[model samples]
Target: MSTETSAKAPGGLRTGVQKFGTFLSGMIMPNIAAFIAWGLLTALFIPTGWLGVEGPVEALRWSGSEGLAAIVDPTIQYLLPLLIAFTGGNVVYGHRGGVVGAVATMGVIVGAAGTIMFIGAMIAGPGAAWVLKMVEKLWDGKIKAGFEMLVNNFSAGFVGFFTGLAAYYWLAPLVKGLTDVLGKAVGWLVDTGLIPLASVIVEPAKVLFLNNAINHGVFTPIGGEQSTEIGHSLLYLVEANPGPGAGLLLALTVFGVGAARATAPGAFLIQFLGGIHEIYFPYVLAKPVLLVALVLGGASGVATNLIFDSGLVAPASPGSIFAVLIQTAPGSHLGVILSVLISAAVTFVVSTLFLLASRKRDLAADAAGEDKLAAAVAQTERNKGKASSVLGGLAGAGAATATQTIQNVIFACDAGMGSSAMGAGVLRKKVQQAGIEGVTVTNKAIANLDGTADLVVTQAQLTERARMKEPNALHVSVGGFMNAPEYDEVVALLLAQQNGSAEEAAAEETATHDAPAIDFGAKPDPATSTATAEGEAPEGATPEVLTRDNVRIHAGSATRDEALREAAGILEAAGAVTGDYLEAMKAREETVSTYMGNGLAIPHGTDAAKDAVLGSALAVIRYDGGVEWGDGDVATFVVGIAGKGDAHLEILQSVAIQFGDDDTVARLKAAETPDELYALLKGGLA
Candidate 1:
């Protein structure tokens, strides 16, 4: 029955520093810096005469003194909260439903009844738990466990919606009031203490090499309120060292390889012709050690620009080589070329060495059999059925048919609602996008659900339960349902199911067979245990998967603390965080839990187990039911070890793509489990 290639994860010295460093790179600065940079741009440029400028002529006619005056204006206050809300949301909740989700949620938080949304978020999980418990009492033992997750997760989303409302209405005012109070206090201190101290340090720093005329005068990639000057300096710097970027491109071609290498062509198409160099961001991120290299190269180019007294008369839109050439001082092409060459040479050597060393470490670790606990999903082939056609045609197709016999979806986690429900939302979006219709998806806690499913997807710890419930369902192990490839394959499988249904129906018609097509109602076992038959499943028992393609990982932050502490504060301030969420997550983690990998993980499971995985995962199995994946690349395989029950063989392949890859293996070995795993995954993904 076991097809998975069992291997232990690599165990070695934990690289805590590197892990934290990666976390800083991924979670802390990237977006925060962007927000700050854009805020300053909005603040400085809008107030200056630049806003009213008509064309290149007006833009070129700006007075430096006037621009400097507008740059420091205090009207730039509104942007701070926007950044905080967006960034805080992303950090806490990992949802980014575009500016709408963040901004609208922010508005709800700041609305007339804004505190409701915040309160709701605080109480969502706990309230959902209470609701589930209440529902459990009403339902019979046969269906109570199976239907628990659907009820809980739906409640969680409902709670979050109201919480967001509270946040907009009630919390915003309190926050604004607190900000004003803090502002006054800080102002008093700054006027009395900081201004004089800053005057001494700032004036000296400006006079010393920090603000030397050449260094200060040339363009730089300025950030904060001083960004205009920095941008101006950076413009000149790019001209001076055209070599650095080109060299980085060449290096990217070598290290990134595959789709990453193809970035060169994409960059060429966008940057060379289109003049958009933003295509380079992924390349920069993929090999983060090269970040220092890029910075050093940029500085070198800036220095070269200052040395050569290079200048740019016009703002370049495309930021391509041609754009640089056209904008640079006439006949300074040689300086540009030399600067680029030198910068590129420096970048190449530094980046190449870093990449080689990292790769070498990965190979060594792999050879030593470390981090193998997280091997790729075992590849296997099995007969799969399609019920889409039956759904498409059945006039009386009820909820049971919608759930058990239709599509290739297995909500096979311990506490299916928390993590599996979110994953289902993602899957539904993806399946819809793939043009597959008449499909149903639902989660079943391992303790229930007869074995009539197309595929039974469950966490590692709950495999036994899934096997017991749906021995007929083709079971597959994917550490967790939320990660990529697993979700992607689930979509593919649904699509295939629809296709298979069509083929089965067509073949039946051709052969003139009178037999009904794969009738779920006829199956005595599934019929007896159908929770949907009791009218419990969503929208008439049709559960859908949540996908990255559609479901947004909205932005937010959450503190590591007791649920009552976090939830109660938000509820008290906003009137929404009502339920006991920490208890819910802990409860969820206990049964058929979501813990999967060492440095990687996802906490989730069916609702049947005593301690459900609370919809998250990190280190060793958070609960007793969780597996002890001893040694060998445990860091990389954490997420994949959780949900071996709800997924199919293909999703396991997707886990391999995400966690079983070379880069993931190396990163896993170089990081701590749990928190560090989340950081590395976030960084690599971002």
Candidate 2:
């Protein structure tokens, strides 16, 4: 929430002009073809045609109005704005339509439509922002960080569209006047010889091959038909180009996907299917310098077309790449060749540069074989146990081994870059806080680290992944080392592992040091173990076993929010997590999804957690799901949290995973329902 603005733009007026120029250039060839087609149908195909069909010559005599309608009716109108908004939304939000969201957004856009979609754009940005925040909260803030930029930039366009529209509508006349004045001033200068030299110096840069290609080769043909009013020629320019344009688009995809991994799926849907160019504007804005490359590319293609005098055979829809190629005239083939080559070359170089620059930071250490061994070695060193040999020898002599056990650990998570680092940080801190040495604490990607670690502490998706990756990790899992969990198991385990008992440590630490003795046994009556024999199973499939295979619970737990906080640690450990946890937890509290009856609070994650698990465990806790929980409907929260890997039955690993079934949930929600809920739970796991 810092109010800072960065000075960079993908393209300004110049870029806009260039885009217009390119569009105009692309149009010319198609316009010519349409003109020819109309003229032919009007002339030779009319009077002498079959089936009493008369051409323009014959038809115009009977009804010139119809002919006019034919020409004007096909023109694209306000649909243009919708197209822009759709693409813009995609670029910003990475979602397809935003149907209801977009509709709500469009009201603002409509309010500003007369000006340019500016007021709408202004409102749309904030509107989308507000809704997205809600989504982030629901998802536990896991997807928020990655999607923020997309949202901001995408929304900016709605603002800009309105702004631009306003500017164009109100300022065009003023701009035209200025242009006239400038033109006169330049003319005067040329006459006086003072400006002639300036023109000479500037003309070369302006006259690069692209201008010639566009103006002479491409623009001339379309401009000719447009001037002649040849059957919707104006609409032809934006049609999808077949050859070079397709290549350019493909290149854009590769570059874009490479830059944004998960975000790319959303972006791709907008760009390719929706045909929205504005979604890509932020990329250019991020690196304004790259606009020059696009310009050069555009200019070069235009110049090449002009040099070869290539022409389009007909107007093609901007949505169809094949149409553009098919419509090129036989004689203008050379221009087509040059256009494709120039655009592709420029795009390849610019995109390649951007891709390389973005990827330099994200490459895996194990990408090359050399780094893998080193990383593995480092990992082994950190995780390997270390203890006093004398103690070990004495224990071994007594038929025991003094093995090192990690009793306390921490897991951290932030949005994206910060989450993983934070988890690792907390782990280190917790290890130090316990005053324990040689404990194995490490950080791993939430997604990949699922079941590997003993105790998982994570922020978002890592928790989800922890649920799936190392369901086994949960028994050993400790709530976040950074945050408090529902239970203080770490403190319990630490005290247990210490040289003295809890009371002894409290006395010794209180006298010698200022630190209070950490208490882990807050829950005097441990949660009723939900694990039952495999005989009782859920309806769709067997209950997910809360064994070492599928759960990662944090050690310590906070007060009421303990389960909530622990959920994040599990998500981080599993890496199937995101969004804002606080918001998500609050919403879940309002309508506790975990309808754990029979004196249990099965606290679970919101729908945003990507993993699917049968209810992880039927929480048979001593306390109910808190009176304040979910409108007091949930006295006991029987949580059914899971990860994405459990899409099917065979893959499921916990009993709680089945709670996700709508029928089961419905029955659980409505059943008289604790006993009914218990029956349902038992039946599902039966």
The candidate that wins on TM-score is 1
RMSD of 1: 19.2
Query: TM-scores, in order shown?
Result: 0.34, 0.28
In angstroms, how far off is 568's CA in candidate 2?
Answer: 12
The lDDT for every candidate, in the order shown, is 0.37, 0.35
Residue-level lDDT of model 1, residues 39-128, one tens digit each, is: 334323433223313212355434443555454323222333333334333333333312222443444334523122322222222222
Cα lDDT tens digits for candidate 2, 63-178? 33344434321222122223333433332233322232244444543443332231233234334433443343443424465685666445444544444444344533443344
TM-score of 1: 0.34
Q: What's the CA error at residue 496 for candidate 1, in Å?
A: 10
Worst 10 residues of 1 by lDDT: 379-388
In order, what is each prediction's RMSD in angstroms?
19.2, 21.7
